[model samples]
Target: MRENEPHRTGPVLIVIGGLPATGKSTVGRAVARRLGGSCLGIGTTRQSLYAFAEHGGDTDTLRHAVTHGLGYSVAYALVEDLLSQGQCVFAECVNSRKATRDAWAALARRTEARFHEVELLCPDPTEHDYWRTAGRALAEP
Candidate 1:
């Protein structure tokens, strides 16, 4: 059996959150990969909203409401499905707002999963600026 499969003694959810360019995606992806699990990114889902909207989807008002709600909605569904299958999940999001973070925590509680929250920060302004400007990190620190 795989390491993750054996460790599936219980559900596990790793939630990574931070400001843009703070490497939340990188960390979440890495952790999930290391554990042979899944990485579900809110930003990816959020970006897809634009593509859907471009395809004659909805009005701006509806798009805005959907964008705000879709990430959490999809993430919660993924978490539930994966956990039910005894799979680990790492969720990456810009959970700067307390409500959003609390929602993730609540989902973990509802699923009876072990919830781990990781808030990333870049201490070096130079590095942070570089990542923000280039839209990528030079390396994971």
Candidate 2:
């Protein structure tokens, strides 16, 4: 949001969750772009943590924290910062556990931001399998 712009609801926290290959990133990024906000992915955060660790900058043991719940923690902090600035955020992740989803909602409440959780599911197994395969192929060098 620009300094001169006005937002009706302050900021919004959009959490997109689903199993792998459910199109969370695609949807999240598209929505973020449309909303003129930021898009964040859990895998991207984890890779960042890994890269920093590889570069020998674990000031707070971030590498070890990544193995735990640091990615979500970092995401929370990032989202909170953006919300404080009146910018919406779209966060896509495999919230495979209920605890993770709950934590995201809790963060939204703590920040007094509107929270939306969208869980994508591919009911067609064939298409889902193709997405999974394509995702793996894309990951391969």
Per-model TM-score versus the true fold? 0.84, 0.84
Per-residue lDDT over 16-73 for candidate 2, one digit per residue giving the tens place of the 0 to 100 score: 9898899999899987887688899998888788778787665458777897988888
In model 2, how large is the Cα lDDT of residue 109? Answer: 85
RMSD after Cα superposition, model 2: 3.9
Error of 1 at 48 (Å): 1.2
Q: Which stretches of candidate 1 lie over 4 Å from their true place?
A: 1-6, 136-141
Top candidate (lDDT): 2
Q: Candidate 1, residues 1-141: lDDT per residue as tens digits?
A: 854454556888888888888988888888788778899988787667656777774558657866678767877887788876767898888888888888888888888888888889999999998888787443323
Alpha-carbon lDDT, every model: 0.80, 0.86
RMSD of candidate 1 to the true fold? 4.1
Residue 12 displacement (Å), model 1: 0.4
